[model samples]
Target: MLRALRSVRSGLHATYLESYFISQCDKLSSKWLTRGLHSAPAEDVAEDAGVTAAVGARSGERPNKSNRNQEVRPFTSIPGPKPLPLLGNKLFFTTIGGYPMERYWESVQRIYEKYGPVVKVERFSGSLDMVIAFRPEDTRKMFQAEGIYPMRPGLGILTHYRSKRPQWFSSPGLVPGNGPEWRRLRSVIHPLLRREVINAYRPAQTEVANDLVRAIAASNQHNTKQDPSRHIISDTLSILFHYTLEAVGVVSLGMRLGCLASTSANCQAQSIIKANIEVLNVLGESMLQPPLYKLFPTRGYRRLSAAQDTICRQVDVEVARRREELALDPEGFTQRHPFLASLMNNPDLSSQDVFLLLIETLQGGIDATATTLGFCLYFLAGHPAVQDKLLKEVQHVQPEIHTLQGLPYLRAVVQETLRLRPSAAARSRVIQEDTIISGYCVPAGTFVVSPPNVACYDPQIFPGA
Candidate 1:
């Protein structure tokens, strides 16, 4: 039967194949659907062979042509590990307590190696069903199937946290949200993230970058060793984080955060940065671990809540400051910081919304940018030829704030680095409706993940792969 379907699939066009697959799936599962027999354990369903075979001894119903073809098959038929009863593959994640959770990427790679391009993993004892795809075609299917409002099933813990603080955030931000609220929030901030708006902040970004270089020079001078190689910034990631936070803060809040300052004068700014880092760490753990934090006020959850408060308080102060400045001298404020002023002018955005938006932008932008920069540095360090080529291009361009655009090779290096080690390694989407992928039926509300780390290595799509 599967062989005949494959033969027909080869001859049919793409659009026709979709309809044909759906029809086949319906025909295959019709008996179980008609008999209301879809609630059995997947293992039992697989072992039963057919409805008649499972119950025929008692009911004396003989296997007919229509009923025989419509027996519901186990989800395990779709190429994955043998799920353990109701727990499914959830135990796979919790095994050894922290080993699998800490090295999740490696674990995922192992699954991909064993199961090929497509695999299913259930979470929370079959409460959540996820289909992970490593092939480009499946990735495209997942994305193309997203209708007008694409739904991303983000961390629910964060959503619950936000819900508790109505005064701070009237609604959840883009990350832990979906549907109309997500759409409305996205549209409100869309203009601020546009090309022209980002380009307008080039001057500010250059200023922050220059300050960073100066700070690095100052720090290097303090090193007793004269050797260039030994004159390393003790914590390079911390320095980059400060640089990125300062840059993002300036662009988003229209204020210099003093993150690169050598002195401890900007205590509040430094505290906010620290809180942001803590928030990210705690949020990541909450996302991976079970929702035990929700039931019991765990230490990690308490820390997360405190960190969030610090971030929100700092952001609120900045927003209020900006609002007061706008009110005092609207014209001068608009001219000095047109982008932020425009956002402030929007009637649709409340002060809390603006504050959350700025916080989200700063939190997301800083760490991701810093991580990407680290990868680029690592790649350049390993590949001297590529580094030398990039150096020559930079020298030729003598890139100033505005002149950086002409260095094609430099841009290519960044692009290649992003392609090779994308900051966002995977993206998740909630299946909004029933869809078929690679001849497998995926029902609505299923969580689908596309791992670019795997797909980007496809030899068919990448010539040198």
Candidate 2:
């Protein structure tokens, strides 16, 4: 059954790819012909016209040394959707439901296809101007030129919440801040999330995975006769959410919430999972829409506030419990969970700071890990051959708690999934200085977005995509 499904999907994908290429060829032909370069191929025309020059243009690359000091041109001259009197592309983004942040990749792709790679998009009545770059070369340049302290734009609602509760959160954690404060927090916790450190927690992670398998089996006991491909549990995302939250909780808080247990349905563990989902949903909406919460206490804003309080309160309780245990026997506490103990021991970070940090870490891990795992399962379910191969590899290794090495096929599956459907579809960076991207002058203070989805689909990079 799965094999049949795979065949159908492959046929559909091929059809789509063929049509896409044909459309692209038409676009290129028209563009080149308009320039009176119809005699040569589009690639040749692009090469002769120095289309790649914009990619490599930078301050130090100038041949004329005397011309390097001149002020660069502004980014306003870039072509984009024309702005109206008050609404700047906001109305275009609006639908019957709301702003489409959930489907942001689709929106970005529409803009990229319509206005070309380096198109400008204005939001919030032109208060926010963003330059969207789809080409891989432009993305490379943007990251390379990002200064010592690379600033990632985050949800504004989170910043507002943190500010309201100043006593609890002294500064925004890694997600919502830049400059010295971000650097300081990142420096303190960076080592804890390093590759080696995370690898050490593999034993705990495997235990959680095992628990998840049991939970799924128990939940689907009544539907055992159903075809594996058509099983209801296969389509449900809640199981993945629970599994990821439990796994991340164990790693972050040095304890399990039993989120995978059958009896955890109405418990505090379940409540925490629900709160995390709500926070993400509310924050995503708040980020795309107007900040009406500041002017009036809106329902979304209120819900976000409640979710934040729930998370912070729970984290505080856990931190207090750990502190009490550490005071009782510091040596034993350090032996059990040295990673978390080390963070608690840091002199610079207060209790509230540690709580806020844990909240950010857990929230970040839950959504990304869950989404990735969900995609992996979806892909593997459709490709039983690959699944069988992976199973054989796993069986051969008889992978122990912390021993996931020598799993090349498993690693490839993950890498390929990320390449195809990355958790972070688009990344934004605040440009600190004037820079040339694809021949366009993108000035400082402009928000620049690089869509990995666009680059990932490039035939040149990933042939046969």
Candidate 3:
């Protein structure tokens, strides 16, 4: 989840931060496994513009001015939610749950309102302290001044876990990687995201999406029988998640998880889905609280370890089966398992590295895609005129679920949904240079961040982008 997840500084809010996790180049802007999931809101994955921009930011447009000699005030001058003695903003953030964007955004809104645009959030009185710059101009400056190896303080718990087990992870397998090793792992994903790869795997995406439709239909039948007027599918989010998991599995795991079965979803499939939920919840917990587990194995750390172990074991079982299928028909493997085939066949990457990438992407992509789809449905339902236009488009392209093009209205609706409801409140980057952010000359190593919810709704900012 490297460059791909970074919301664009150029107009559109690309959904970043906790709302949107992981920024891998392969999670294609528009051309991902979730593409045909209701013909959802997607960036142009084949174009891979974000990947190129990310790589360029790291390789070409950097080695930025390290103004060690500049006449700037000390970094401590930057203001944020004040910290207590030996305990920074821990008390303030303990109540800030990372999910449900509005809840987290509410806290951020208060901070922005109190501290103006740029506020230094002193979390636990350590280097973990962050400076949030709330303007688009400031955000663009951070990216421009970000050095070659722009370091993001990704999941600290995840990085710590991987450090303890270097045998299984190659520089944390892109989730928390940095420098050359991070680039090496990221390189393999770039080649596999071409139009041919996306085109080859459209069947799998379409197949799972169709299964979702069937699941919805099946549920509607049961619901209509129970109460004639209650025709809607109960637990819509759960069904959507099943579809997203199966859709992502097509690429991430290179096999079906039976998540969208005609009858009941199998036990193993349900467990995998549950395991992912556990991982996301733990991640949110780690962010809310301090990382004391970094020093020794805390109970929370144990929970994270167990969840990660479950995902790893499950992925290995599926990967081993895929390898067997590949050995039987080597030539057909490329067409059948485009992404996996590339990863497994690569000499530079280890087997462990490949599994880590797939599992990470699977964990990273599913919930966000499903949630976005859900929001798209909610907004469409509320506005029948817009919904009717989209229905007409879907009908024109329907009968054949794979013919996804020519639906400008669907694309427009998805784009609008993401703009209105992004994946995360904000994304963070540690500035490597002494840069001016929101008029303050923020020194090197300060985290230049953004206020997530404020930017999207403010008419004066985007002016209906």
| Best TM-score among the predictions, by candidate number | 2
Ranking by TM-score: 2, 3, 1
lDDT of 1 by residue, 139-232 (tens): 6567666777889866766777887888888787888888898899899887765656655666666677667666655554333466433344
Give candidate 2's total backbone clashes: 1
**Relative to the unseen true structure, what is the C-alpha lDDT of residue 289 in candidate 2, on a scale of 0 to 100?**
74
Task: Assess the local accuracy of residue 199 in candidate 1 as a C-alpha lDDT between 0 and 100.
Answer: 57
Model 3, range 1-465, lDDT digits (tens) per residue?
Answer: 111221111111111111111122223323321232223222211111232233333343422222232222334567766677777666665445222333677777777778787787776336466788776556666776678876777788888877776546656767677766777777777677676676676656656666776676666533446655444555666766777778778887888888879435477667777787887777777775567997789887888788777777788788898888888887798778888888888888787788778877788777787777676666665676777766655653432333323545655666666666766656668887666654355656766676545655555544663
Order candidates by lDDT, high to low. Answer: 2, 3, 1
Q: Per-residue alpha-carbon lDDT of model 2 for 148-232, expressed as tens digits?
A: 8887676777888898997679887788888888898889887775655655566666677777666555544233466433443
- Runs off by more than 4 Å, candidate 2: 1-74, 96-99, 123-125, 221-231, 263-266, 398-405
Residue 95 lDDT in candidate 2:
66
TM-scores, all candidates, are: 0.78, 0.80, 0.79
**Which ranges of candidate 1 are over 4 A from the true structure?**
1-76, 95-99, 123-126, 221-231, 263-266, 396-405
Give the TM-score (vs. native) of candidate 2.
0.80
- Lowest-scoring 10 consecutive residues by lDDT in candidate 1? 1-10
Query: 1 or 2, which is superior by lDDT?
Result: 2
Error of 2 at 329 (Å): 1.8
Regarding lDDT, does 2 or 3 come out ahead?
A: 2
